[model samples]
Target: MSILVYINSNGNKIAKNSFEAVTYAKKLGDVTVVTNGKADNTILADLGKYGASKVLVDRSFDGTDEQQITRMVATAAEKVGAETVVFSDDLVGKAVAPRLSVKMNAGLISSATGVPQGDGTVPVNVFSGKAFAFVKANTSKKIISLLPNSIPVEEVGGSASIEEFNGNAGDTRVRVKGINRPEGDIPLPEAELVVSAGRGLKGPENWGMIEDLAKALGAATACSRPVADADWRPHHEHVGQTGVAIRPNLYIAIGISGAIQHLAGVNGSKTIVVINTDKEAPFFKAADYGVVGDAFEVVPKLVEAVKKFKASN
Candidate 1:
Protein backbone atom coordinates (compact mmCIF):
# COMPACT_ATOMS: atom_id res chain seq x y z
CA MET A 1 0.00 0.00 0.00
CA SER A 2 1.25 3.48 -0.84
CA ILE A 3 1.14 5.82 2.21
CA LEU A 4 1.12 9.62 2.34
CA VAL A 5 2.48 10.88 5.67
CA TYR A 6 1.78 14.49 6.66
CA ILE A 7 5.13 15.97 7.71
CA ASN A 8 4.13 18.41 10.46
CA SER A 9 7.01 20.76 11.20
CA ASN A 10 7.50 23.75 13.51
CA GLY A 11 8.54 25.77 10.39
CA ASN A 12 12.09 25.33 11.63
CA LYS A 13 12.36 21.52 11.74
CA ILE A 14 10.33 18.34 12.11
CA ALA A 15 7.99 18.11 15.07
CA LYS A 16 8.76 15.14 17.34
CA ASN A 17 5.31 13.64 16.88
CA SER A 18 5.70 13.93 13.08
CA PHE A 19 8.79 11.80 13.29
CA GLU A 20 6.71 9.13 15.04
CA ALA A 21 4.00 9.50 12.37
CA VAL A 22 6.50 9.04 9.53
CA THR A 23 8.07 6.05 11.26
CA TYR A 24 4.61 4.50 11.73
CA ALA A 25 3.71 5.11 8.08
CA LYS A 26 6.92 3.48 6.90
CA LYS A 27 5.80 0.21 8.48
CA LEU A 28 2.68 0.05 6.28
CA GLY A 29 4.32 0.54 2.85
CA ASP A 30 6.09 2.96 0.56
CA VAL A 31 5.90 6.39 2.26
CA THR A 32 5.80 9.90 0.78
CA VAL A 33 5.94 13.09 2.89
CA VAL A 34 3.85 16.29 2.70
CA THR A 35 4.91 19.58 4.27
CA ASN A 36 3.23 23.00 4.47
CA GLY A 37 5.94 25.53 3.71
CA LYS A 38 9.41 25.74 2.22
CA ALA A 39 11.35 24.27 5.10
CA ASP A 40 15.15 24.54 5.33
CA ASN A 41 17.21 22.01 3.34
CA THR A 42 18.66 20.61 6.56
CA ILE A 43 15.14 20.00 7.86
CA LEU A 44 14.09 18.29 4.63
CA ALA A 45 17.21 16.16 4.71
CA ASP A 46 16.24 14.64 8.07
CA LEU A 47 13.10 13.20 6.46
CA GLY A 48 15.44 10.84 4.61
CA LYS A 49 16.48 9.24 7.90
CA TYR A 50 12.90 8.10 8.53
CA GLY A 51 12.39 6.28 5.18
CA ALA A 52 10.47 9.00 3.30
CA SER A 53 10.86 8.29 -0.43
CA LYS A 54 9.75 11.74 -1.62
CA VAL A 55 8.95 15.07 0.04
CA LEU A 56 6.21 17.34 -1.38
CA VAL A 57 6.61 20.92 -0.15
CA ASP A 58 3.72 23.36 -0.69
CA ARG A 59 4.74 26.97 -0.22
CA SER A 60 1.19 28.17 -0.83
CA PHE A 61 0.14 26.85 2.55
CA ASP A 62 0.27 30.00 4.67
CA GLY A 63 -0.08 27.84 7.83
CA THR A 64 -3.72 28.96 8.17
CA ASP A 65 -6.96 28.22 6.24
CA GLU A 66 -7.82 24.62 7.05
CA GLN A 67 -10.15 24.25 4.03
CA GLN A 68 -7.36 25.15 1.60
CA ILE A 69 -4.84 22.94 3.33
CA THR A 70 -7.29 20.04 3.29
CA ARG A 71 -7.71 20.43 -0.42
CA MET A 72 -3.94 20.49 -0.88
CA VAL A 73 -3.62 17.19 1.05
CA ALA A 74 -6.44 15.52 -0.84
CA THR A 75 -4.90 16.51 -4.16
CA ALA A 76 -1.52 15.15 -3.10
CA ALA A 77 -3.03 11.86 -1.98
CA GLU A 78 -4.64 11.47 -5.38
CA LYS A 79 -1.38 12.29 -7.17
CA VAL A 80 0.53 9.62 -5.20
CA GLY A 81 -2.26 7.01 -5.35
CA ALA A 82 -2.08 6.71 -1.59
CA GLU A 83 -4.54 4.30 -0.05
CA THR A 84 -3.63 5.40 3.47
CA VAL A 85 -2.97 8.89 4.86
CA VAL A 86 -1.30 9.23 8.25
CA PHE A 87 -1.04 12.18 10.62
CA SER A 88 0.35 12.89 14.06
CA ASP A 89 -2.46 13.52 16.51
CA ASP A 90 -1.05 16.94 17.36
CA LEU A 91 -2.73 20.35 17.07
CA VAL A 92 -2.70 20.46 13.26
CA GLY A 93 -3.64 16.83 12.89
CA LYS A 94 -6.59 17.26 15.26
CA ALA A 95 -7.88 20.15 13.11
CA VAL A 96 -7.33 18.94 9.54
CA ALA A 97 -7.65 15.15 9.66
CA PRO A 98 -11.41 15.13 10.20
CA ARG A 99 -11.94 17.73 7.47
CA LEU A 100 -9.84 15.71 5.02
CA SER A 101 -11.73 12.56 5.94
CA VAL A 102 -15.01 14.31 5.16
CA LYS A 103 -13.67 15.73 1.89
CA MET A 104 -12.35 12.36 0.71
CA ASN A 105 -15.22 10.28 2.12
CA ALA A 106 -12.66 8.24 4.02
CA GLY A 107 -12.68 6.57 7.43
CA LEU A 108 -10.82 8.35 10.25
CA ILE A 109 -9.34 6.60 13.28
CA SER A 110 -7.96 9.18 15.69
CA SER A 111 -5.59 8.38 18.55
CA ALA A 112 -4.57 5.11 16.94
CA THR A 113 -2.00 3.09 18.88
CA GLY A 114 -0.60 1.26 15.91
CA VAL A 115 -1.02 0.50 12.20
CA PRO A 116 -3.99 -1.47 11.05
CA GLN A 117 -3.52 -5.19 11.09
CA GLY A 118 -5.05 -7.71 8.75
CA ASP A 119 -8.81 -7.21 8.54
CA GLY A 120 -7.99 -3.49 8.90
CA THR A 121 -8.38 -3.53 12.66
CA VAL A 122 -6.64 -0.74 14.58
CA PRO A 123 -6.19 -0.39 18.35
CA VAL A 124 -7.13 2.84 20.10
CA ASN A 125 -7.52 4.25 23.58
CA VAL A 126 -11.04 5.02 24.68
CA PHE A 127 -12.57 6.98 27.60
CA SER A 128 -9.50 9.03 28.42
CA GLY A 129 -7.28 5.98 27.89
CA LYS A 130 -8.91 3.92 30.59
CA ALA A 131 -9.70 1.17 28.09
CA PHE A 132 -8.58 -0.16 24.70
CA ALA A 133 -10.81 -0.70 21.69
CA PHE A 134 -10.21 -2.12 18.24
CA VAL A 135 -11.61 -0.08 15.38
CA LYS A 136 -12.03 -0.77 11.68
CA ALA A 137 -12.85 1.42 8.72
CA ASN A 138 -15.28 0.24 6.07
CA THR A 139 -14.31 2.88 3.53
CA SER A 140 -11.83 2.33 0.70
CA LYS A 141 -9.56 5.15 1.94
CA LYS A 142 -8.25 5.32 5.52
CA ILE A 143 -7.00 8.33 7.48
CA ILE A 144 -5.18 7.70 10.72
CA SER A 145 -4.20 10.19 13.44
CA LEU A 146 -1.72 8.18 15.45
CA LEU A 147 -1.33 9.08 19.10
CA PRO A 148 1.94 10.74 20.06
CA ASN A 149 4.61 8.36 21.48
CA SER A 150 2.44 5.35 20.72
CA ILE A 151 4.84 4.06 18.09
CA PRO A 152 8.60 4.09 18.27
CA VAL A 153 10.42 6.15 15.65
CA GLU A 154 12.47 3.82 13.45
CA GLU A 155 15.18 5.08 11.09
CA VAL A 156 15.73 3.19 7.84
CA GLY A 157 18.09 5.87 6.52
CA GLY A 158 16.56 6.10 3.03
CA SER A 159 17.10 9.53 1.43
CA ALA A 160 14.10 11.38 -0.01
CA SER A 161 13.95 13.68 -3.08
CA ILE A 162 12.48 17.16 -2.62
CA GLU A 163 9.71 18.25 -5.01
CA GLU A 164 7.75 21.50 -5.08
CA PHE A 165 4.01 21.56 -5.83
CA ASN A 166 1.87 24.52 -6.82
CA GLY A 167 -1.56 24.73 -5.24
CA ASN A 168 -4.12 27.35 -4.23
CA ALA A 169 -4.23 28.00 -0.50
CA GLY A 170 -7.56 29.72 -1.12
CA ASP A 171 -8.65 32.77 0.93
CA THR A 172 -6.19 33.93 3.54
CA ARG A 173 -8.36 33.94 6.69
CA VAL A 174 -7.57 33.30 10.38
CA ARG A 175 -3.96 34.38 10.17
CA VAL A 176 -1.84 33.90 13.31
CA LYS A 177 -0.52 37.20 14.69
CA GLY A 178 2.20 35.81 16.92
CA ILE A 179 3.04 33.01 19.33
CA ASN A 180 4.27 33.49 22.91
CA ARG A 181 5.67 30.14 23.92
CA PRO A 182 6.43 29.55 27.61
CA GLU A 183 10.14 29.30 28.31
CA GLY A 184 11.06 25.70 29.05
CA ASP A 185 13.36 22.99 27.77
CA ILE A 186 10.54 20.51 27.20
CA PRO A 187 7.02 21.18 26.03
CA LEU A 188 4.69 19.43 28.53
CA PRO A 189 2.33 17.81 26.06
CA GLU A 190 5.20 16.22 24.13
CA ALA A 191 7.24 15.20 27.13
CA GLU A 192 7.82 11.46 27.58
CA LEU A 193 8.43 11.90 31.30
CA VAL A 194 6.59 14.53 33.34
CA VAL A 195 7.17 15.66 36.92
CA SER A 196 4.18 17.47 38.32
CA ALA A 197 3.45 18.88 41.80
CA GLY A 198 0.32 20.00 43.57
CA ARG A 199 -0.64 22.23 46.57
CA GLY A 200 1.43 20.05 48.86
CA LEU A 201 4.51 21.87 47.67
CA LYS A 202 3.31 24.77 49.87
CA GLY A 203 4.16 27.91 47.87
CA PRO A 204 6.05 28.87 44.73
CA GLU A 205 9.06 29.61 46.93
CA ASN A 206 9.36 25.90 47.83
CA TRP A 207 9.29 24.91 44.13
CA GLY A 208 13.05 24.53 44.06
CA MET A 209 12.80 20.90 45.21
CA ILE A 210 10.35 20.09 42.45
CA GLU A 211 12.48 21.83 39.87
CA ASP A 212 15.61 20.04 41.05
CA LEU A 213 13.92 16.65 40.81
CA ALA A 214 12.49 17.45 37.40
CA LYS A 215 15.90 18.57 36.16
CA ALA A 216 17.50 15.40 37.41
CA LEU A 217 14.85 13.27 35.73
CA GLY A 218 14.94 15.33 32.54
CA ALA A 219 11.19 15.72 32.70
CA ALA A 220 8.79 18.59 32.07
CA THR A 221 7.30 20.31 35.10
CA ALA A 222 3.57 20.74 35.50
CA CYS A 223 0.99 21.63 38.19
CA SER A 224 -2.56 20.85 39.11
CA ARG A 225 -5.38 23.32 38.42
CA PRO A 226 -5.43 24.85 41.92
CA VAL A 227 -1.68 25.39 41.78
CA ALA A 228 -2.07 27.37 38.60
CA ASP A 229 -5.18 29.16 39.85
CA ALA A 230 -3.30 30.22 42.93
CA ASP A 231 -0.69 31.79 40.62
CA TRP A 232 2.08 29.62 41.98
CA ARG A 233 2.67 28.41 38.42
CA PRO A 234 1.68 29.68 35.02
CA HIS A 235 -1.74 28.71 33.70
CA HIS A 236 -0.11 27.09 30.69
CA GLU A 237 1.58 24.63 33.05
CA HIS A 238 -1.74 23.40 34.36
CA VAL A 239 -2.80 19.86 33.43
CA GLY A 240 -6.36 18.75 34.13
CA GLN A 241 -9.71 18.04 32.53
CA THR A 242 -10.08 21.72 31.61
CA GLY A 243 -6.42 22.08 30.75
CA VAL A 244 -3.94 20.28 28.52
CA ALA A 245 -4.14 16.47 28.59
CA ILE A 246 -0.95 14.45 28.39
CA ARG A 247 -0.12 10.78 27.86
CA PRO A 248 3.47 10.44 28.90
CA ASN A 249 5.44 7.24 29.52
CA LEU A 250 6.16 8.18 33.12
CA TYR A 251 4.36 10.72 35.33
CA ILE A 252 5.57 11.48 38.85
CA ALA A 253 3.26 13.43 41.12
CA ILE A 254 4.63 14.90 44.33
CA GLY A 255 2.67 16.51 47.18
CA ILE A 256 -0.51 17.24 45.32
CA SER A 257 -3.43 15.10 46.36
CA GLY A 258 -4.88 13.57 43.21
CA ALA A 259 -8.20 15.25 42.66
CA ILE A 260 -10.63 13.71 40.18
CA GLN A 261 -10.13 16.63 37.79
CA HIS A 262 -6.36 16.25 37.90
CA LEU A 263 -6.65 12.52 37.27
CA ALA A 264 -8.76 13.21 34.21
CA GLY A 265 -5.80 14.93 32.58
CA VAL A 266 -3.00 12.50 33.49
CA ASN A 267 -4.87 9.19 33.47
CA GLY A 268 -3.49 8.43 30.04
CA SER A 269 0.08 8.16 31.26
CA LYS A 270 1.60 4.67 30.94
CA THR A 271 2.90 4.70 34.52
CA ILE A 272 1.99 6.92 37.47
CA VAL A 273 4.05 7.45 40.61
CA VAL A 274 2.46 9.33 43.45
CA ILE A 275 4.29 10.70 46.49
CA ASN A 276 1.97 12.24 49.01
CA THR A 277 2.11 12.67 52.76
CA ASP A 278 -1.49 11.56 53.02
CA LYS A 279 -1.82 7.83 52.74
CA GLU A 280 -5.49 8.43 52.07
CA ALA A 281 -4.71 10.57 49.02
CA PRO A 282 -6.96 9.54 46.11
CA PHE A 283 -4.04 9.63 43.75
CA PHE A 284 -2.47 6.65 45.44
CA LYS A 285 -5.29 4.45 44.22
CA ALA A 286 -4.46 5.31 40.60
CA ALA A 287 -0.73 5.14 41.03
CA ASP A 288 1.33 2.19 39.89
CA TYR A 289 3.77 3.07 42.66
CA GLY A 290 3.11 5.07 45.80
CA VAL A 291 5.35 6.76 48.34
CA VAL A 292 3.76 8.10 51.51
CA GLY A 293 6.27 10.70 52.59
CA ASP A 294 6.96 14.40 52.82
CA ALA A 295 7.93 16.04 49.53
CA PHE A 296 10.69 18.07 51.21
CA GLU A 297 12.45 14.92 52.42
CA VAL A 298 11.55 12.47 49.63
CA VAL A 299 12.25 14.86 46.74
CA PRO A 300 15.75 15.80 47.92
CA LYS A 301 16.73 12.16 48.32
CA LEU A 302 15.23 11.32 44.96
CA VAL A 303 17.27 14.03 43.31
CA GLU A 304 20.45 12.81 44.97
CA ALA A 305 19.70 9.24 43.91
CA VAL A 306 19.20 10.34 40.33
CA LYS A 307 22.41 12.35 40.41
CA LYS A 308 24.39 9.48 41.91
CA PHE A 309 22.98 7.04 39.35
CA LYS A 310 23.89 9.36 36.51
CA ALA A 311 27.37 9.79 37.88
CA SER A 312 27.92 6.05 38.24
CA ASN A 313 26.52 5.27 34.80
Candidate 2:
Protein backbone atom coordinates (compact mmCIF):
# COMPACT_ATOMS: atom_id res chain seq x y z
CA MET A 1 0.00 0.00 0.00
CA SER A 2 1.29 3.47 -0.81
CA ILE A 3 0.29 6.05 1.81
CA LEU A 4 0.77 9.80 1.60
CA VAL A 5 0.42 12.45 4.33
CA TYR A 6 -0.13 16.17 3.85
CA ILE A 7 2.41 18.25 5.70
CA ASN A 8 1.37 21.64 7.16
CA SER A 9 4.71 23.18 7.84
CA ASN A 10 5.05 25.64 10.71
CA GLY A 11 7.79 27.88 9.36
CA ASN A 12 10.58 25.48 8.43
CA LYS A 13 9.17 22.77 10.73
CA ILE A 14 6.13 20.61 10.12
CA ALA A 15 3.14 21.21 12.38
CA LYS A 16 3.12 18.93 15.41
CA ASN A 17 -0.14 17.29 14.34
CA SER A 18 1.37 16.57 10.91
CA PHE A 19 4.05 14.58 12.69
CA GLU A 20 1.32 12.48 14.26
CA ALA A 21 -0.30 12.04 10.86
CA VAL A 22 3.03 10.97 9.43
CA THR A 23 3.37 8.49 12.27
CA TYR A 24 0.10 6.90 11.21
CA ALA A 25 1.02 6.98 7.52
CA LYS A 26 4.21 5.07 8.28
CA LYS A 27 2.22 2.00 9.33
CA LEU A 28 0.29 1.47 6.09
CA GLY A 29 3.21 1.36 3.62
CA ASP A 30 5.83 3.52 2.03
CA VAL A 31 4.86 7.00 3.32
CA THR A 32 5.15 10.07 1.12
CA VAL A 33 4.86 13.66 2.38
CA VAL A 34 3.15 16.42 0.40
CA THR A 35 3.96 20.04 1.22
CA ASN A 36 2.89 23.38 -0.23
CA GLY A 37 4.99 26.37 -1.24
CA LYS A 38 8.74 26.37 -0.74
CA ALA A 39 10.01 25.04 2.58
CA ASP A 40 13.39 24.09 3.93
CA ASN A 41 14.36 20.83 2.26
CA THR A 42 15.92 19.98 5.60
CA ILE A 43 12.45 20.13 7.13
CA LEU A 44 11.07 17.83 4.45
CA ALA A 45 14.09 15.59 4.91
CA ASP A 46 13.35 15.31 8.64
CA LEU A 47 10.02 13.72 7.73
CA GLY A 48 12.02 10.66 6.72
CA LYS A 49 12.84 10.35 10.39
CA TYR A 50 9.11 9.87 10.86
CA GLY A 51 8.87 7.18 8.14
CA ALA A 52 8.25 9.13 4.96
CA SER A 53 10.02 7.88 1.82
CA LYS A 54 9.06 10.70 -0.57
CA VAL A 55 8.13 14.42 -0.42
CA LEU A 56 5.97 16.26 -2.97
CA VAL A 57 5.85 20.06 -3.21
CA ASP A 58 3.05 22.21 -4.66
CA ARG A 59 3.66 25.92 -4.22
CA SER A 60 0.13 26.96 -5.17
CA PHE A 61 -1.38 25.34 -2.07
CA ASP A 62 0.40 27.88 0.13
CA GLY A 63 -2.41 30.37 -0.34
CA THR A 64 -5.52 30.18 1.85
CA ASP A 65 -7.75 29.88 -1.19
CA GLU A 66 -9.37 26.48 -0.64
CA GLN A 67 -9.82 25.65 -4.32
CA GLN A 68 -6.12 26.00 -5.01
CA ILE A 69 -5.42 23.50 -2.21
CA THR A 70 -8.16 21.08 -3.23
CA ARG A 71 -6.91 21.00 -6.81
CA MET A 72 -3.30 20.69 -5.71
CA VAL A 73 -4.03 17.86 -3.31
CA ALA A 74 -6.20 16.07 -5.87
CA THR A 75 -3.49 16.36 -8.47
CA ALA A 76 -0.74 15.39 -6.03
CA ALA A 77 -2.58 12.29 -4.77
CA GLU A 78 -3.06 11.01 -8.30
CA LYS A 79 0.54 11.73 -9.20
CA VAL A 80 1.90 9.91 -6.13
CA GLY A 81 -0.38 6.88 -6.72
CA ALA A 82 -1.30 7.05 -3.06
CA GLU A 83 -3.93 4.62 -1.83
CA THR A 84 -4.32 6.39 1.49
CA VAL A 85 -4.09 10.10 2.29
CA VAL A 86 -3.53 11.31 5.86
CA PHE A 87 -4.14 14.78 7.27
CA SER A 88 -4.19 16.44 10.66
CA ASP A 89 -7.78 17.31 11.52
CA ASP A 90 -6.91 20.92 12.30
CA LEU A 91 -8.22 24.07 10.61
CA VAL A 92 -6.48 23.52 7.28
CA GLY A 93 -7.30 19.84 7.07
CA LYS A 94 -10.96 20.48 7.87
CA ALA A 95 -11.06 22.95 5.03
CA VAL A 96 -9.32 20.72 2.47
CA ALA A 97 -9.98 17.05 3.37
CA PRO A 98 -13.68 16.84 2.52
CA ARG A 99 -13.16 18.46 -0.88
CA LEU A 100 -10.24 16.18 -1.65
CA SER A 101 -12.29 13.17 -0.60
CA VAL A 102 -15.12 14.18 -2.88
CA LYS A 103 -12.79 14.81 -5.80
CA MET A 104 -11.06 11.45 -5.40
CA ASN A 105 -14.15 9.45 -4.41
CA ALA A 106 -12.23 8.37 -1.35
CA GLY A 107 -13.75 7.32 1.94
CA LEU A 108 -13.09 9.83 4.69
CA ILE A 109 -12.68 9.42 8.45
CA SER A 110 -12.62 12.87 10.00
CA SER A 111 -11.56 13.38 13.62
CA ALA A 112 -10.11 9.88 13.60
CA THR A 113 -8.07 9.14 16.72
CA GLY A 114 -6.83 5.59 16.84
CA VAL A 115 -4.93 3.57 14.30
CA PRO A 116 -6.89 1.56 11.78
CA GLN A 117 -8.02 -1.85 12.91
CA GLY A 118 -8.08 -4.83 10.60
CA ASP A 119 -9.81 -4.35 7.23
CA GLY A 120 -9.29 -0.57 7.05
CA THR A 121 -11.46 0.18 10.10
CA VAL A 122 -10.63 3.32 12.11
CA PRO A 123 -12.25 4.78 15.23
CA VAL A 124 -13.78 8.26 15.45
CA ASN A 125 -15.73 10.22 18.02
CA VAL A 126 -19.39 10.85 17.35
CA PHE A 127 -22.07 13.13 18.88
CA SER A 128 -19.62 15.97 19.37
CA GLY A 129 -16.81 13.89 20.83
CA LYS A 130 -19.31 12.19 23.09
CA ALA A 131 -19.67 8.77 21.41
CA PHE A 132 -17.64 6.19 19.52
CA ALA A 133 -17.98 4.91 15.97
CA PHE A 134 -15.97 2.47 13.88
CA VAL A 135 -15.72 3.12 10.15
CA LYS A 136 -14.31 1.17 7.25
CA ALA A 137 -14.03 2.51 3.74
CA ASN A 138 -14.65 -0.17 1.10
CA THR A 139 -13.15 1.94 -1.64
CA SER A 140 -9.56 1.72 -2.80
CA LYS A 141 -8.80 5.31 -1.81
CA LYS A 142 -8.96 6.34 1.89
CA ILE A 143 -8.74 9.73 3.59
CA ILE A 144 -7.91 9.91 7.27
CA SER A 145 -8.04 13.19 9.26
CA LEU A 146 -6.44 12.77 12.66
CA LEU A 147 -7.30 14.84 15.71
CA PRO A 148 -4.51 16.80 17.29
CA ASN A 149 -3.05 15.30 20.51
CA SER A 150 -4.69 12.01 19.55
CA ILE A 151 -1.45 10.09 19.09
CA PRO A 152 2.20 10.40 20.01
CA VAL A 153 4.67 11.27 17.28
CA GLU A 154 7.26 8.60 16.54
CA GLU A 155 10.85 9.59 15.77
CA VAL A 156 13.46 7.83 13.66
CA GLY A 157 16.87 8.89 12.37
CA GLY A 158 17.53 9.19 8.63
CA SER A 159 17.03 11.82 5.95
CA ALA A 160 14.09 11.22 3.64
CA SER A 161 14.84 11.50 -0.07
CA ILE A 162 13.15 14.53 -1.60
CA GLU A 163 11.20 14.14 -4.84
CA GLU A 164 9.11 16.47 -6.99
CA PHE A 165 5.70 15.54 -8.35
CA ASN A 166 4.66 18.18 -10.89
CA GLY A 167 1.20 19.49 -11.76
CA ASN A 168 -0.39 22.73 -13.04
CA ALA A 169 -2.53 23.62 -10.01
CA GLY A 170 -5.84 25.44 -10.55
CA ASP A 171 -6.75 28.93 -9.28
CA THR A 172 -8.74 29.59 -6.11
CA ARG A 173 -11.88 31.70 -6.11
CA VAL A 174 -11.30 32.83 -2.54
CA ARG A 175 -7.97 34.39 -1.65
CA VAL A 176 -6.31 35.29 1.63
CA LYS A 177 -5.80 39.05 1.48
CA GLY A 178 -4.12 39.02 4.87
CA ILE A 179 -3.49 36.95 7.98
CA ASN A 180 -4.14 37.85 11.63
CA ARG A 181 -2.20 35.93 14.27
CA PRO A 182 -3.07 35.48 17.91
CA GLU A 183 -0.86 36.91 20.60
CA GLY A 184 1.14 34.79 23.09
CA ASP A 185 3.75 32.06 23.17
CA ILE A 186 1.42 29.38 24.52
CA PRO A 187 -1.24 28.05 22.22
CA LEU A 188 -4.33 27.66 24.40
CA PRO A 189 -5.82 24.45 23.08
CA GLU A 190 -2.47 22.73 22.88
CA ALA A 191 -1.30 23.98 26.27
CA GLU A 192 -0.73 21.43 29.00
CA LEU A 193 -2.54 23.66 31.54
CA VAL A 194 -5.33 26.21 31.11
CA VAL A 195 -6.75 28.89 33.40
CA SER A 196 -10.14 30.22 32.41
CA ALA A 197 -12.66 32.80 33.61
CA GLY A 198 -16.38 33.22 33.32
CA ARG A 199 -19.04 35.81 34.20
CA GLY A 200 -17.66 35.73 37.71
CA LEU A 201 -14.48 37.46 36.65
CA LYS A 202 -16.92 40.40 36.57
CA GLY A 203 -15.60 41.50 33.16
CA PRO A 204 -12.65 41.29 30.78
CA GLU A 205 -10.68 43.87 32.69
CA ASN A 206 -10.17 41.41 35.49
CA TRP A 207 -8.48 39.03 33.08
CA GLY A 208 -5.16 40.37 34.30
CA MET A 209 -5.29 38.01 37.26
CA ILE A 210 -6.08 35.04 35.07
CA GLU A 211 -3.33 36.02 32.66
CA ASP A 212 -0.86 36.37 35.51
CA LEU A 213 -1.74 32.97 36.87
CA ALA A 214 -1.48 31.43 33.42
CA LYS A 215 1.89 33.04 32.82
CA ALA A 216 3.13 31.87 36.18
CA LEU A 217 2.06 28.29 35.53
CA GLY A 218 3.08 28.35 31.89
CA ALA A 219 -0.59 27.78 31.08
CA ALA A 220 -3.00 29.11 28.51
CA THR A 221 -5.83 31.56 29.20
CA ALA A 222 -9.41 31.14 28.09
CA CYS A 223 -12.90 32.46 28.79
CA SER A 224 -16.44 31.13 28.87
CA ARG A 225 -18.65 31.59 25.83
CA PRO A 226 -20.67 34.46 27.25
CA VAL A 227 -17.54 36.35 28.17
CA ALA A 228 -16.07 35.89 24.74
CA ASP A 229 -19.24 36.77 22.92
CA ALA A 230 -19.56 39.84 25.07
CA ASP A 231 -16.21 40.97 23.66
CA TRP A 232 -14.61 40.66 27.05
CA ARG A 233 -12.15 38.18 25.57
CA PRO A 234 -10.96 37.24 22.14
CA HIS A 235 -13.09 34.67 20.35
CA HIS A 236 -10.03 32.49 19.97
CA GLU A 237 -9.88 32.14 23.77
CA HIS A 238 -13.44 30.97 24.10
CA VAL A 239 -14.01 27.34 25.14
CA GLY A 240 -17.35 25.55 25.04
CA GLN A 241 -19.58 23.47 22.80
CA THR A 242 -20.24 26.40 20.43
CA GLY A 243 -16.63 27.54 20.60
CA VAL A 244 -13.23 25.91 20.96
CA ALA A 245 -12.89 22.56 22.72
CA ILE A 246 -9.84 21.55 24.68
CA ARG A 247 -8.46 18.62 26.68
CA PRO A 248 -5.61 20.14 28.59
CA ASN A 249 -3.89 18.29 31.42
CA LEU A 250 -5.22 20.73 33.99
CA TYR A 251 -8.25 23.03 33.59
CA ILE A 252 -8.89 25.77 36.08
CA ALA A 253 -12.23 27.55 35.93
CA ILE A 254 -12.67 30.81 37.83
CA GLY A 255 -16.23 31.98 38.45
CA ILE A 256 -17.77 29.78 35.74
CA SER A 257 -21.14 28.22 36.43
CA GLY A 258 -20.22 25.18 34.33
CA ALA A 259 -23.26 24.70 32.13
CA ILE A 260 -23.43 21.43 30.22
CA GLN A 261 -22.17 22.96 26.98
CA HIS A 262 -19.28 24.54 28.84
CA LEU A 263 -18.33 21.39 30.70
CA ALA A 264 -18.54 19.20 27.63
CA GLY A 265 -15.45 20.93 26.23
CA VAL A 266 -13.32 20.72 29.36
CA ASN A 267 -14.46 17.41 30.84
CA GLY A 268 -11.69 15.64 29.00
CA SER A 269 -9.06 17.48 31.02
CA LYS A 270 -7.13 15.21 33.33
CA THR A 271 -7.85 17.49 36.30
CA ILE A 272 -10.46 20.22 36.74
CA VAL A 273 -10.39 23.01 39.31
CA VAL A 274 -13.36 25.26 39.97
CA ILE A 275 -13.29 28.55 41.88
CA ASN A 276 -16.53 30.35 42.49
CA THR A 277 -18.14 32.22 45.32
CA ASP A 278 -21.31 30.20 44.93
CA LYS A 279 -20.84 26.69 46.24
CA GLU A 280 -23.85 25.56 44.26
CA ALA A 281 -22.43 26.50 40.87
CA PRO A 282 -22.76 23.48 38.55
CA PHE A 283 -19.05 23.70 37.84
CA PHE A 284 -18.34 22.30 41.30
CA LYS A 285 -19.98 19.04 40.43
CA ALA A 286 -17.35 18.31 37.81
CA ALA A 287 -14.44 19.86 39.62
CA ASP A 288 -11.65 17.81 41.12
CA TYR A 289 -10.97 20.73 43.49
CA GLY A 290 -13.42 23.46 44.51
CA VAL A 291 -12.86 26.76 46.22
CA VAL A 292 -15.92 28.76 47.13
CA GLY A 293 -14.57 32.30 47.16
CA ASP A 294 -14.30 35.57 45.34
CA ALA A 295 -12.08 35.24 42.27
CA PHE A 296 -10.49 38.62 42.82
CA GLU A 297 -9.18 37.72 46.27
CA VAL A 298 -8.63 34.02 45.68
CA VAL A 299 -6.83 34.45 42.37
CA PRO A 300 -4.11 36.62 43.84
CA LYS A 301 -3.51 34.06 46.58
CA LEU A 302 -3.48 31.21 44.06
CA VAL A 303 -1.00 33.05 41.90
CA GLU A 304 1.24 33.69 44.92
CA ALA A 305 1.11 30.02 45.91
CA VAL A 306 1.96 28.79 42.41
CA LYS A 307 4.73 31.36 42.15
CA LYS A 308 6.08 30.29 45.51
CA PHE A 309 5.91 26.67 44.53
CA LYS A 310 7.93 27.44 41.42
CA ALA A 311 10.43 29.41 43.43
CA SER A 312 10.76 26.62 45.97
CA ASN A 313 11.48 24.08 43.31
* Top of the candidates by lDDT: 1
Q: Write the per-residue lDDT of candidate 2 for residues 185-215, one digit (tens) a residue.
A: 8776567789999999887778899989999
Q: How many residue pairs clash in each candidate?
A: 0, 0
Candidate 2 off by > 4 Å: 10-13
Estimated TM-score per prediction? Answer: 0.95, 0.89
lDDT of 2 at 141: 94
lDDT of 1 by residue, 1-313 (tens): 8999886666786767888888999899998898777588668867889988888888876574677778888988998999999988877888889999998899999989987888889998787767889999999999999988787778988678888886545666577888788879998878999999999989999999888988999999999999999999999899988887888999999987888889988998889999999999999999999999999999999999999999999
**What lDDT would candidate 2 get against the real structure?**
0.83
Pairing residues by index, what is the TM-score of model 1? 0.95
Q: What's the TM for model 2?
A: 0.89
Cα error, candidate 1, residue 2 (Å): 1.2
Each model's lDDT comes to 0.87, 0.83
What residue pairs are clashing in model 1? none
Candidate 1 ranges with C-alpha deviation above 4 Å: none
What is the C-alpha RMSD, rounded to one decimal, of candidate 2? 2.3
